[model samples]
Target: MTPLSPDILDAVAHGAHHDPHSVLGVHESSDGWVIRARRPLAAEVVAVLDDGTAVPLTHLRGGIWEATVESFPGRYTVRATYDGTEHVTDDGYRHSPSIGELDLHLIAEGRHEELWRVLGAHVREIDGSQGVAFTVWAPNARAVRIKGDFNGWDGSGSAMRSMGGSGVWELFVPGIGVGTRYKFEILTRGGQWIEKADPMARAAEVPPATASVVTDTAYEWSDDAWIEERSRTAPVDRPMSIYELHLGSWKQGLSYRDAADQIIDYVGAQGFTHVEFLPLAEHPFGGSWGYQVSGYYAPTSRFGSPDDLRYLIDRLHQAGIGVIMDWVPGHFPKDAFALARFDGEALYEHPDPRRGEHKDWGTLIFDYGRNEVRNFLVANALYWFEEFHVDGLRVDAVASMLYLDYSRNDGEWAPNQFGGRENLEAIRFLQEVNATSYKRYPGIAMIAEESTSFPGVTAPTSAAGLGFGFKWNMGWMNDSLQYIGRDPMYRSHHEGELSFSFVYAFSENFVLPISHDEVVHGKGSLFGRMPGDHWQKLANMRAFLAYMWGHPGKQLLFMGQEFGQMSEWSESRDLDWWMLDQPAHRQLHGFVAELNRVYKDHAPLWSRDHDGAAFSRLGAPAWNPNVLAFARRDHHGNTVAVICNFSGVPLGDFPLDLPESGTWTEVLNSDAEAFGGSGQGNLGAVTTDARGSATLTLPPLGVLWLHHRADA
Candidate 1:
């Protein structure tokens, strides 16, 4: 039997060998072929060949059993018999490593853009046998094994062989197919054993259950036409009115497929160009709103399978609505069975608590300095685009990723090599991801939700900028909301809040967002923010929305805002959809629709959005904080003037500079009663004298949209 080496048997018994294949599999010696197997608690072990030739093995110490065969038949099985139980399994050690050496080299260099394809449990056909090819990067692990339902959740049968010097462990288990629930059982360098969910798992057991599921992301996509058109079109020059939503509560009793139809119809009906979904990755806590991700590559099973999400994205594209997903690469949940202390060591996160932990969020920050970690996140970004065919990605909490001192006081954070508060590693990772994505996905948008004044947020990477297509204008949202919340009696005192945005409006490609962040956490709904009676509140909201549309940036509003839902957004339940039955709610909804329609129809409104010369302020900033006027002009000099009266009382003879002298039509009136307004408004059209100026009576708590009759 080639004299079963005692040293080799001891290494196998201890599970301390780097390559178990050398000792456990069938190997040729000078004399003949010898087979070795380990079945710890077995009474008898037999080598069973393909033709059912059972050769009994001589027992050695510590479960080592050996048998000598005349020749190697290549494929054979090991049958172990214990007390009244017989276990038949293929020789896992005989299989070749599923990962190639080149992949290992690229992984170590951190240049594997398609990293997920290599580092996760994949259902692959290896050696003509259909099964799963599993791989994981747990550098600090002493040993790694695959355990799943197929093996009674046991790891003793097979231990993954670590690729030399690469810290990656791989195994190809024959006969395990798709939908198999599995996890990596890793023995850490510290001698502690743990089971962790695969970080690159393409699908997971929908929360409540943390096992990673083997899935084939092989769904047919119908978004080819949309994708082709998207690649050829430029998004910055187009009108983008986004309706941000949380899929869980956007509607009631709806799966991903149902919500796809419902949401697309609603967004399209509202004349919005895009839908921005809150974080949709797999998360354990529903309240985190998918922000505290567990499976970075798996779409939250709360909706449906990965294919179900693709179906949703497909439907949205088919219905002419672009899908922008909110991606949270800033932090991840510290679930014990997940990434936390994976391999019983700080594998995925930084070693230091201050650098790794986000106290405010109770989550762990990513160790961006690690190349494999960087590869993980970058590949995840591309996975969403390539697999699900999402149109854009709104990177969440970018401000958190940018600053090392984010949400931390003195002595609580670490500085970069340059002694700056910037996270240099994260910055490089971000820049690389942005550059790579833009280079690969031509017209795909990469927007940032960065609230800080870090500079060049939306600049091209070639210009030493962050290379984002757009940034959420948090400053504008905060300023406008605070200004609108005050009584009209003291509004002019805060007039600068409204005008200050113009000074930096063109500084970056901005999406003026009144997102869910503005409405939750005791901040109150946008409708509930305005002062005074219901009528005044409605008027103020309409006027504010018109101003947002008139302003020089794209717009994004959360789901309930369009209908003026008074209740705050909740992740557990649906929005107060029944509120739409109220006349006020329906009118507000219709008003937003009209605003979107008008925004898209008027080239002047969107064509010159980022151009300073195309937008000019009328009157003075503080002349009447309760009243302000502005004119926006298109390339052809077609102009639309927006004037607002913020006070409760009406004003007469409000003179404003006009681009031309002619009959001016009042296209929209906030107090027009159709939007639950006071019905006070300027008549259909008014005459402007030859001085390029117009004088008109304004409605109480109203905003006006006027254009020359010739252009209207």
Candidate 2:
């Protein structure tokens, strides 16, 4: 018999091998997994397994490549040739990794099952407090105590007592209301001290970060009339404008209530239908943008009390605005008061080094295979929608969750079935959350921020989909931003930027986002992302905005983008309001308002069953070399034509294909004097001819919206 490698033995020992016949899912028939690239096909490639085993993955079929190797049970990494083989590509990606296990029995309700179940079955509550009552499944703890501020940094009071063979512990306390913090001090059979957050606490102190808090959540929603107006899901046909925001930094340093008041007022005035907040869950570090979650049950206390959060949602609902909170279930921070040393081991995480660590984010990933873990996540997702009345959840970092080999360097990460990156357990958990959320609250939407080319994530669950309602269109965002930032002379080569996304536009309901991710870590601001002189920069921005609003997807803009804030955003201070004094910056702001105004008034902007002609029948480049023209049609066959020029040179006699012979009125223009533009064109309107085309004068780097009127 072949000598078993230590990794192979450990994998089986720790319950990592369930099939009994496979390791890393590399059976004889399928020795390698394949990856297909998008454009700019890579030339060279290298691959390595978790045990430092290297294998060369080769490009073979239709931008797809594959490789295979002998027995290896952990994750792997790959580097590909890009930019003429001179630039090594770092797309922040990783392949697959597997895990191994050990056979040590500490405690069990019966026979300590998977890590998730073991940690999810114990219940503890505060003493004499109208607060949280939560359960975990640690059947082996000799003593489990509730720690943190409510008990004055002690666990002796409000302690959990074992309840016989049920393998459960129970406690009930009063007076520990919202903001009363706590954690679990668990003593295992091995006599080790493990500190953990109360798994079901409603709100925890997030910044000046400390212990989890108990919150008796009760909100007197005075928006019953408003609730009725938005109780049902909005039609997919209506304009879907989302105001993306970060709860901590969006409005100077405001509480959840403060942010909500500001956003609700803004949304109502600006004609947007939704407000999407960045992650609000309890996290050890603020810099992770809430991606490094710890307390799944609690809202971040840095904002306000749990009830205050609920009040924020209520106020938003009152203004007929939808609310969506960012939810991170992919990984947890390794803080002592969090999930790190729970039960004196990596109880919530995988025992195998490959599965336990997330290399890119440097966080601890969850053991999703454990039923109890899946249950915990699913329950948490459902709880957010049900308890908080949140209209939706924007799941963060889903690509990382779905893949086992994300961001692992050579010989680092793990693999799964088919020697691939798919984490079946994570996929199963997402499906569970989708089903539960839709079943419980049909109106609540679920959005995924999955950058990987994962198909069907927003499709119907009955059709084997992940069941999210929408997903962030990362491809569109990346490609369009790059194209728009280029000089007009170089744009023709990249003019397909807007059209290229059409390949996957219909695959899911996509949100075209200029999110916080693009504005940080030296990426500069949105306006900064553009090239050219000041006037040219503003013009390019206006053109980009016009095209984005006219694109065939939902819309989302980060908070400060509306007013052309010049500085990069930071949670430490307010956005740069002083920049609005500049002419070019002010012009960009006014252009956004006009875009929003036009988007709100026109049915053609978002009407479903989009007229195919909108993306077809383009005139040649010479008519207006820098301009892109398209038309959107409503159900009644009414058409609205949009044209954008990204150039710095003015062009007259720009010929545009006309749908009718009547005169055309210029309903909107980014260069209008009121918006700080030079006012170089006719102020109110213009006319068009009937011979399938018309001529008009277009100002430098301007956009125009023309409507058909029968009379000249």
Give per-model TM-scores.
Answer: 0.95, 0.77
Q: Which candidate is the best by lDDT?
A: 1
Every model: Cα RMSD to truth: 2.4, 20.8
TM-score of 1: 0.95
Model 2 segments more than 4 A misplaced: 1-134, 148-159, 163-167, 174-180, 609-617, 620-625, 659-663, 680-691, 708-712
Model 1, residue pairs in steric clash = 492-625
- lDDT tens readout by residue for model 2, 1-712: 2333655434332322222123222333344343222112567665555566656665543333445555442444455677656332211112111111221122221222223222332222322113334344455676676666654776543345454444455444333444556677777677766777666556666566666654454477776665555546443566778888877776567987777767776667666778888888887788777778877877787877878888998888877787888898888887777776466766678777788888666778888887555666777887787667888888988998887777767578678867887888889888878877887776667889999888789877889899887788999999998888787887766677756786667677788899888888888888887788766666667767777887777788887877667678786677776776876676677677678878878777777523344444346435444677776666655556677777777677777776656666677877777766667664556655547567777777777777653333
Clashes in candidate 2: how many?
35
Instruction: Give the whole-model CA lDDT for all candidates, comma-separated.
Output: 0.85, 0.66
In angstroms, the error of model 2 at 616 is 3.8
Please give the lDDT score for candidate 2: 0.66
Lowest-sum lDDT 10-residue window in model 2: 91-100
- Which runs in model 1 stand beyond 4 Å of their true positions? 1-17, 40-56, 79-89, 620-623, 708-712
